[model samples]
Target: LAKTTQPISMDSYEGQEVNITCSHNNIATNDYITWYQQFPSQGPRFIIQGYKTKVTNEVASLFIPADRKSSTLSLPRVSLSDTAVYYCLVGDLNRDDKIIFGKGTRLHILP
Candidate 1:
């Protein structure tokens, strides 16, 4: 598993775009960059995943560079309800690996 680093907290106003970046210095070739968003008293919800280049869904977009050492989760026109903790994980999702959850980046959407 590749260790990830992310900001402790971020703040943005409603209707503004929010980007959270994570760094995985020891990412492996088979590793995939996955992002999750979690609200209070709820499990982490899958946001996006990408191996390289860029991936976009209706919810958010994920960007991964060629080196795969870093990734960014971009949320367009965020709202107050989108406030949550965002987690960045790097690993092979095929096998049953013991996944560890760290203190993720807490995103605060202000009015």
Candidate 2:
């Protein structure tokens, strides 16, 4: 598993776009960059994932650079309800590896 680094917290106003970046200096070729969002007492919800370049879903977009050392999760027009802890994970999903989650970035959507 590739260790990831993210901000401890972030703040954004309603209707504004938020981009949370994650750094994985030792990413492997088979590793995939995955983002998750978790509210209080709830399990982390999948946001997006990408191997390289860019990938987008209805909820958010994921951007991975050429080196694959870093990735960004972009949320468009956030609301107060969007506040949550966002996690960035890098690993091979195909394998049965234990998922180790670090302290994720806490996003605060302000009014």
Candidate 3:
């Protein structure tokens, strides 16, 4: 399995762009990087995903380099309501392997 590393916590203010980077040293070619965001008392929701290069959605953008060793999840103009925990998942969806989740990065959006 590919391991992910992220900061334990982050602090940002309203209307700020926050980028959380996740490192996966042993990521495989078929593994896709996926980002999820979870609120204090809610389930995690998919933010963005990418195999290579960059992928963007209304909520966020995912950037993966050619090496695929690391990925960055960018949240544009985040607000106080964006406070939550973000997780990075690296896995092959076509496989039946178990999913392992690393300790998520806690994000605090200030007023």
lDDT by residue for model 3 (27-111), tens: 9878888899999789999888899999999999988888989999999999988999999999996886576789989999999
Query: What C-alpha lDDT values do all the predictions have?
Result: 0.91, 0.93, 0.91
Instruction: Sort the predicted structures by lDDT, highest score first.
Output: 2, 3, 1
- So what's the TM-score on candidate 3? 0.97
Ranking by TM-score: 3, 2, 1
Q: TM-score of every model?
A: 0.95, 0.96, 0.97
- Candidate 1 per-residue lDDT over residues 1-111, each given as its tens digit: 688999999999999999899999998888888899999999999989899999999999998888888999999999999999999988886766656566899999999
The reply for model 3, stretches above 4 Å from the true place, is: none
Off by over 4 Å in 2: none
Provide the clashing-pair count of each candidate structure: 0, 0, 0
> Candidate 3, clashing residue pairs?
none
Model 2 deviation from native, Cα RMSD in Å? 0.9
- Candidates 1 and 3 compared: the better one by lDDT is 3
Candidate number with the higher TM-score (1 or 3): 3
Count of backbone collisions in candidate 3: 0
